[model samples]
Every structure is written in C-alpha cells, then in structure tokens.
Target: MALATVRFDAGQPVDLEDSLLGGQAHRWKRASHPELVEGEWYSGVLRGVLVLIRQHGQAIEFLSSSSDPQAMIPRIRDHLRLDDDLKAIQAEIAGDPNVAAQVERYPGLRVLRQDPWECLIAYICSANSNIETIHRNMERLSDEFGEPLTLPNPQGEGTGTITRNAFPKPVDLAEAGEAELRRLKLGFRAPYVHQAAIAVAERRLDLAHLVAAPYQEAKAELMALKGIGDKIADCIALMSLEKMEAFPIDVWVRRALADWYFPGQKTPTNRILLEWAQRYFGRYAGYANQYLFHGRRLRDRKPAQPESG
Candidate 1:
C-alpha cells in the first residue's frame, strides 16, 4: 500500500512515540524497518488493522492495510484524539507546579482512545503486573485466539512480509475458557479475562453504552467486573469510556502526589486522592494523572550508558 499523510492544526502537537508506547496502550512497537521511513516509525494493529505511522514535524505519515488508506484518517484521528486542544488542557491543568513541569517536559503527550472491550481485558490482565509483562500477556492472548494477517513489504513487491495477530473479539475469548487463557501465562487474571469476555459476548455488559454514561456511572459498572478495582476501573474509563476526568491512582502517581502534593503530611487513601485530583484538575484530571505518572516514571528510570568506541 502507498503511504499517506494526515496533517493536523499547528496548535495540536503529538509525540507519537511517547503517546503510543507510553503506558496508555501496549500493542505498538518501534518499526523494525526504520531504514525505509523518516523520523521514528511505529507498527501496530489497531482494531484489527495493521498501521505504520511516523511523526513528520507537526503532522504524521501513515500506511495501513485498508483498501483505501484515506478511509482510515478518521479512525486514526479519533484513536490519537488529534482534535483535543492540548494548549487549553495544559492551561487548565498546569496550575500545579509539578504538573506544569510535566506539561512542559512532555508537551506532545496525549491520551489515547482505545477500544473499550480491548481496554477492559487489557487492564484486567494488568492487575499486579508491570507494563512489559502486560504486553507479553496481551500478545500471547492475541496470538492464541485472534485472526492472523500478513502484509507485503511497504517498499514494494518483494519476499519480505510482516505478520501480526488482531486482538481477539469477546466471543473468541469467552469460548476459549480459562484453562486455555492460563496456558498463555495470564495466571490469576485468566478467570477475570474469561468472565469479562463472556459478559461482553453474551450482551450482559454493553461497553459502548458506557461511553455515553456519566463518568461515575461508567466507572461503577466497570468496577462491578471481577479483578477490576479503583485504579483499573479508572484506567478503562479514562482510556476508552470517554471519561477524561477519571483519575487513576497507581504506585507512580501515588509517589508523585506524596512527594509533590502531600510532602510532610501522611498520604491519604486512594479514594481521597482521586477526589482531590478531580476537584483540583477539574475536567481533565485524567490528563493530569497521565502526565504526572509518565513524568515520575521517566524521572526514576536510569539513563542509558554510552557505548565505548
């Protein structure tokens, strides 16, 4: 397929690497065929379509598996939330010094809008697991049950091809059974993933409806599912259910808040922290949480060492 470009308003800036490979989603990887593209390239399957994207200054160039690549512009726009006014959101949440620093540091970071069913199961597998482990688990689940696709080399006809598996549908996992999921190394999360899939596949849970529901209502519904707690529920809400104000308090966020917001005072419960964040950041509390969380993680990570000549 031919490559296509999607230009955005200058006011909207996106750091594709930080946004895609950042904690919000786990499917994307730095393109292995970087010699064929300019800037940084990422390859991932979004809602079953294999997409290759690269940041070109303020705009992005992309290639996809669709018959008409232009038809994917809307999906790509919606997925990256390209229309969100980053300047305005930063102005609203930057009142805090700590958040302001993060806003300045990672200016192009934007919240991703992921598929609700996929996001739900992804977070269900996230309980007590790190990002790398979550990626492995999700990849295993997809490989085990999803439909496989092959793409010819973008550079033109050749023997080279790329293989990927789409994220499975609810019915796929529902029928796979927990034992089969455990074989993928999902551990205790296998049952939760299975039950959640069954709920969606059987129509007992309507993930689409939650998108239009109130933030609290959507969060409550997600929390009703097994293995979903306050943090995971907020994750599903913020990333997929259109609840931008849902603040997910995890370890990194907890530490940031403790050091920056509650220095000498004892740390409050997660419930209180969530309430405080919502009240402080108002409608964009989720954005605030993401910036703080990402910033804190980057700060704690050690720098790479230089290679000797």
Candidate 2:
C-alpha cells in the first residue's frame, strides 16, 4: 500500500463492520484472507469512496477524505461526533426487563451508517431475500452495471477488479431491460430494479429528500414506489435517510423480539413489531433495532449490549 495520509470528518460516528458488513456490501475482495486484528489498517472502497479502515478490535476507523491523513487525524479527532443519544434509545428499549437483559449482554453493538444512495437500492433488493443471496445479487449488479475500479491486493499480491462506484444512477438502469437484470440473476427483483431505476431517472420518485423529511412522510413516500412495501419503506427511511426514529421490522428482528417477549409464541407480524418498536423504543428505536440486528447476525447468538456510561 502506498504511504498516503487520509482525513475524515465524521459528521456522525461510523461503525465499519456494522455499516459495511451488516448489509449488501459484505463480500469485499482481498489479496488474501488477511488475519484482521485490532488496530490493523486496510484500504478498500465503501460506497465508491476510498477509505482506510483500521480494525481497532472493538470499533473501526473510517477515513472519508484521502488527503493528508496525518493532518486529517487531529481534525477528525476533534470533529467526530458520537451519537450518545442512542443511550436514551437503549434505555427506552430496555424498559422491558428482558429486552434490557439482552441489551446488557451485547454492549458494543451499534447501528450501521451507510451511504444513502446505496442503502436505498440495496434494501429495496432485500425484500424476500437472505444476506448471502443479497450479496451475490449485489455483486452481479455491480458486475453488470456498476463502474469498474482496480484494487490492490491487501496481501501484496496481484490486483483485481471490484465494483468501485455507486450503484448505477436510476437513469443507467433505465437504459437496460428487465432481461439484462434477469441475466444478472436478480430473479424476481429484475423488474422491480428496472422500474425503480426508471422512476428515479424520470424524476417520478425522489429518494434523497427522505433523509431529511419527517419519518412518517418519508415512509409514506417510499411506500408509494411500485415495489416497496411497509418494511422496505421503513428501511429506506432509517438506513438511507438516517431517520433514527424509523423502525424497520425484518424476519430476524421479528424472531429476536418474539423470542425475547413471547417465547414459544408464533413469530410476530411486521405490523405488530413496528407498533411495538415505536411505542417502546421511541425516537431511537431504529438505532436500537440496528444494534440488535447486527449483534444477532454478526456475533453469533448473543444479544446487543450498550457500552458502559
């Protein structure tokens, strides 16, 4: 790796593993399966931005600006803002004694912050799918439509190609037919993807504003899209737009919540989970749900706990 310094102004705190791995951008190409250890630094692309992330064991380092890294360090140290308000969210979810116990068991878990555009399309593909399949489909989409970037081998081996740009703009996808996407093996998501791209390209839909809009309005607008349902709508609002109050209920969260609150009971429906989350977790409900989701998926069977105050 070249000796270059990078700077990052973390408008909000970032969790590399949770943010990158918990969703569609999981299958990163490396020269070798480098043994990731604490404080280990590696360079890769996240959401088309070149970043140098350090595995601090507990948390990851994110460099958003690739200018003088040494000079950027002090600025980032001074500018980075942790969302400690999540503690209040944790308390709200923890109001239920059992949920509190689970939260206590997995303290280091946090909500992932991803690029809004990528999160928008990625979660749209997430409907009725598994992580592994989502990863495969995302890779295929990149191979088919995403811009190409050459990457160096982390192990000092030969270079390789990985999707290096944002998911194609909606116009780009609108140029292709459903058959082309189907060829990428998107399965039933092909038409959905095509129409979404068309929607964005034709100015029929607006995705960026959802981030700043009120949660309810954002959810309503997202749901108005052809393929989006309630769950996917909430996902766009929460993950893409950074609406912390938006609670997205997927099968895993439903299972976790059911196990915690109604053991031996049938899995709760998405509607019920959403209502419960809004009532119990309040504004930070989305943050708490994210932590719980990552804890369950990435860290084996453990529940997410909060860091000590």
Best by lDDT: 1
Name the regions of candidate 2 deviating beyond 4 angstroms: 5-15, 24-44, 57-88, 151-166, 264-268, 298-309
Number of clashing residue pairs in every model?
0, 7
Judging by TM-score against the true structure, name the best candidate: 1
Candidate 1 error regions (>4 Å): 1-11, 34-39, 302-309
- In candidate 1, the residue pairs with backbone N, CA or C atoms under 3 Å apart (3 or more residues apart, or in different chains) clash, namely none
lDDT of 1 by residue, 1-309 (tens): 533444443347888878998878988888787545545678888888888887667877777777767777788888988879888999999998999999999999999999999999889988887777777888898898988866556666654666789999999999999999988899999999999999999988999999999998888888888899999999999999989999998888888999999999999999999999999999999999999989987788433311000
The Cα local distance difference test for each model comes to: 0.85, 0.60
lDDT, candidate 2, residue 246?
Answer: 80
Instruction: Give residue 108's lDDT in candidate 2 (0 to 100).
Output: 40
